[model samples]
Target: MHADPRDARSVIEQDAMTWRQMLIVLLCVLLNGLDGFDVLSISFASPGIAAEWGVDRAALGIILSIELVGMALGSIALGWAADRVGRVPIMIGSLLVMAAGMSAAALSTGVVMLACIRLVTGIGIGGMLACNNAVVAEVSSLKYRAGAVALMAAGYPFGAIVGGSIASSLLVEGTWRDIFWLGAGMTIAFLPAIILLVPESPEIILRRNSPDRALAKINRTMKRLGHAALDTVVPIARDETGDSSGLFRGAMRRITTLLVIAYFFHMLMFYFVLKWIPKIVVDLGYEPASAGSVLVWANIGGVTGSLLFSYLTTRLPLRGLLIGVFAFSFLALVWFGMNATGLGELKTAAALVGFFANAGVVGLYALVAASYPAHLRAGGTGLVIGLGRGGAAAGPAVAGFLFVGGFGLPLVALMMGVGSLVAAGAIFVLRSPPKAPVRP
Candidate 1:
């Protein structure tokens, strides 16, 4: 009897993962890590850029916010486009955009020019994130999907660490322009590997094309993935009666809304820590270099947290895991706020906050990937992420306002702590989706 290829998830679930599949996941992780470098490179180079441009901290803040706006736009638009087009093409195109933008940014003479370039770069980073998350999830077996996504999530912090180290060393001998140039060059270097190794999602081809075309595409992908060719392709059974609005309809509407709320509040707290933790450390009497090191430690914690989350998903329900993570994040923030003062205490607090917050966000990505159907996965993921960028953008600004409004560090910490609690509550109320079957 011929094997049924109707359900893409079933095909992946039935096959034991091979080196080819592992390579696809690794490629995605590397791409996302590069994106992390690109996204946070501005932060690493900002002091040098500001000094050269004669701009103050406020001006630099504007520069940061503009890129977030571009990211929000890119995540929504390109993410939806990935569904209609394909993930690989979108991923490649976005990388090109990032390279061009970073290269242009290196030559920018004025703040306005640099801001525009950063916006373009942000668009590329944001678009890549949504597509990458969906593609990684699609290609992995159910048994390993969470682990794969968690590994991919670690790429961001890994990139940040790599970018931060390079920028720190290069800044002693070079200019901010040198940093952007290096980032651009590094991104371009990955193009060949991506084009050679990554295949378009088999699910996308089968969902969007005619049977003849789908069969050919499926066989091509299978061969690339080191699997035998299939005799034929059958489309996954799905109700076509619903409106094309995708994730916003029926049960998905509730799920989408809850995810958006959770993402927004979680990001609000997350960006707050990421953007301000160093400054907070400095205010507590640490040297600038020491403060920076603390931030790096936090990112290291993020990597650890992501890997832990991957392992934990195997042992716990998604909803409970996320809720617990967010709850712990809130407590960590409160602890950091109320008691962290000495060097050791500050470092420990930062790591704890980073661990829980970053893990919570990655958990959300995994949950979103598993909840949506293959056809709508990228778009749904994109929409939620795009909306969440609003919170990410607002986070730092709100924190700044709180500082200006005479809120002490403790108070500011409490406010962010509240955001985490709200996020936890959102997850707490969310109804978990029914478990999908894993075919042997």
Candidate 2:
């Protein structure tokens, strides 16, 4: 039998990245940057915020965990919702919630109030990231989608740089509230653009009860871009067929397992170092400013991984590249944690770890994304992240426990390094379906 036209067209659309695709990637990346910046800012200003509110550090840690809690909930709940309710509405709602939480943070006088507001901010961060990343992955043409996701990811680090720079300057003359105000301000600017520019994911719409409406959305997306000169159009694949229960699908189980394992190990290493390294550097006798600079180098390493791996992803198999990158990261962390004698060695190791680890994590998302056909992409995306978020949520807390228990840097590093190895093994079991085309 001839293949359905709608299915063919929809698949084609999700598979490639056009100019419009780039715009989506850019917006998602910038929004993600805003998210990343907020996460970093809290760390930078934690002491100041604690002092101003006269709260214990434990209270501040709660405030910090608030967003992560929201993200774990967001990825699972909102990802399910995105597949059901739609991508654009959830994305827009995320920004609004983020704005509310951030504004509340700027206005708070006590730790309880700050944590409450931060809970709202966490919801926004979780929802936006879970939904948008899925949307970006689902809407792109197959050839460029992986790299596009990577390119969009570049926004995250840039936002961190922006937030850090603003914090550094404001700390000299202002309070931590100024940092929240800055975040609220940045998110607000993007809010309007998202409303005007972002359309719903064609894949999600296609899976709905109304194929006619889904096709209309496709035409609208094509018309909005002024490029309707196509010989083929992707059609809606399912109303009930295939699978929507992202994690339960047979095709997804292994991919989901692999992606989550990778995300966990990567986040464990990422957060452990990010949370403690400044203090670690200080313990080694560096000045406070110099200690913070080690992270700066590490963040740069993450950026390098994001960019470089995005390139390699297009040229190489996703699983192979992730394995190699994680292996490299594992070795780098063990070396850095065990034998880094000074600032120079630490910086080198930190960057190398960041490069491989961060990219490996993103590559997992892209890989899981590809395993699902159009109908399940959003659900699959969310489930993978929900698992990752679980790991992420626990990573820092685990690190704190280890640190309080007097675990040495090498011991913690060994745990994360071994985690990476486990993740690499998990990827070996993952396989895309017989029907789905291998990513180019």
Best by lDDT: 1
Instruction: List model 2 lDDT by residue over 327-398, tens digit each.
Output: 887888888798658889888887777777777766776676667666566566676676676666566567
Candidate 2 residue 240 Cα shift, in angstroms, is 7.2
Q: What is the lDDT of residue 285 in candidate 2?
A: 74
Q: Which pairs, if any, clash in model 1?
A: none
RMSD values, in order shown: 3.3, 4.5
Once model 2 is optimally superposed onto the true structure by TM-score, how far is the C-alpha of residue 347 displaced, in angstroms? 3.6
Instruction: List runs of model 1 lying over 4 Å from the truth.
Output: 1-10, 240-246, 278-289, 337-345, 370-377, 432-440
Task: Compose the digit string of candidate 1's lDDT tens values, residues 170-279.
Answer: 76677778878989999999889878988888767966898788887887787777777776776656653223487888988888898888898888888777777655
